[model samples]
Target: MKTDPERFILENTSVLSPPHVPEIRLHLASEVHDLWLKTEEDLEEIGLPPPFWAFAWAGGQGLARYILDHPETVEGKRVLDFASGSGLVAIAAAKAGAVEVLAADIDPWARTAVRLNAALNDADLAFTDDDLIGRSVDFDVVLAGDVFYDSDFARALVEWFVNLAESGCLVLVGDPGRSYRPTAHLDPLATYEVPVTRALEDSEVKKTTVWKFRQ
Candidate 1:
């Protein structure tokens, strides 16, 4: 099939908006425990309006930025970035020298974005679709970001993390303290004041926290 013009434009562009220029120079990794890829222009072309409209969560972006600054966390480890939005976390893991990285998301657009961004950054990532649901894989670390906005989804995701952790995978999550964050199973690891443009359906400027699975 012929590629869509918007997708084509996003694939070829470097910078998307003026504010995004800084992010363009910075690499992003998945905060979710799956495969994710990121591109600067994915949000606009996907029809998401500003802020959340850009690709990925500021929390995820922040975490990726952090990992880039501190590569020891992922170097030589096998990693997974689940619910990989713009695949920022996955990209970060790859850049940080993870031996293997996978970015996973339910959204098809997200998967495409991950592939494009990985190519843009010259990073290698494994991408998976819903076919991997209910399946488990061995990974040293798993990351997630901004995934607790909805109660039901948060609960389910947390449960999955708990299972992963029990299986010996280290799990990490970056949350903006959304209403649905599961307080019981998570322990705060670090906190960040992420600068954000309004991209989500609600609110702007999210202050996020990074947490590790406790149980």
Candidate 2:
């Protein structure tokens, strides 16, 4: 790794609130400190992943809004935020009074980002860098935001989320019409026209949906 995760994140991002969920603030990349301009080759050269943690995605913003608006969804429950980019949803769960909140992401940079964000929000959260796919879920609720972008990951995640739902855990996901989201396995809960950066998405507003995993 060419740059330290903590140092890079601290230097490259500014704290800001996402458009859809302004109640929570996150460290996000802006035009002044853009990570999006960096190509995959540049990232590979630096031993970094795609830097997904550097922005507030539409799906995550919608999910965080839902959780904040409906505190009962997480209050006193054990919750896991899977693929927790920027720790937005996980911090929301923690603020909503979840007894325990775990933010899991495979990237070391993501782990560093989540930790710092949690600290910034004064929220208690646990973090794991291990890939938790196919593992038994210990939490009462599982939340995933914008995790269906990758085909391979979406396939594995769908099966695991279904199994978790069947096992009596309440599983929820937020997605913005990703190609791999398993519609057959989801029950629609709410939809939001989430505002996002055009630099990252095709439009400035994305129609994102929150769904419950059907058992």
Candidate 3:
């Protein structure tokens, strides 16, 4: 990568906790408007992705809250946190006693952010950049937060999530009514009024739902 992600993140962000889940702290951009635009232009120049890791999104906050509140959901299980921006959900799983936790995202910048955030919370987690959408994997629980925004991507994930659920792996997701989220296969586990950055979302508070995927 052309840009030094760790140095940039450290220099630009603040140590803070998400509103709904305060137990874990992350490096976040306090003033997202300027930082968000700056990162967009900088990353565009360097051919890197936008920094989704710079904020604790609503879906992630809700999912992390659920995992911390219901520790038994992930206790003693091998877990996967897919699209793990900043590793928030993965860290919560680790705190909840998951035997092993793997956080996966395609962004290289997210890799650095996850590592730094994990250290802040003293949580042990492994990370991968591999695209595991259609691939079968061994895991007791799979966690996804704030996905399903795009039509094509959500289409692919639905099939993969269904396969995991049908194969007896517990699949869970947190969503804030994204346009493409499939509600038919989801069993609502919990609901949360999660605080979010107004710059990134239309509302300051999002009505988020944590759902268990079922066959």
**Clashes per candidate, residues 3 or more apart or on different chains:** 37, 0, 0
Writing each residue's lDDT as its tens digit, candidate 2 over 1-83 gives: 45677887887789998888887778888862247445233355544445788888888988998899889999999999999
Residue-level lDDT of model 1, residues 1-215, one tens digit each, is 24553464364444432121243332232121111123224333434322222355766866676666667888999998887766777888898899999998776455666776677677888987664434687889888877787777777787788888888888888887778888799888767666664534255566677788975
TM-score of 2: 0.93
Count of clashing pairs, candidate 1: 37
Question: Model-by-model lDDT, in order?
Answer: 0.66, 0.88, 0.92
Clashing pairs in 3: none
- Sort by TM-score, top down from the best: 3, 2, 1
TM-score per candidate, in order? 0.76, 0.93, 0.95
What are the RMSD figures for all models against the true structure?
Answer: 6.7, 2.1, 1.6
**Model 3 agreement with the true structure over 1-215: per-residue lDDT tens digits:** 33688888898899999999989999999887677666766576644444778889888999999999999999999999999998999999999999999999997688999999999999999999999999998999999999999999999999999999999999999999999999999999999999998888999999999999987
Candidate 1: where is the Cα deviation over 4 Å?
1-54, 131-134, 199-204
> Which of the two, 2 or 3, has more lDDT?
3
* Rank ordering of all candidates by lDDT, starting from the highest: 3, 2, 1
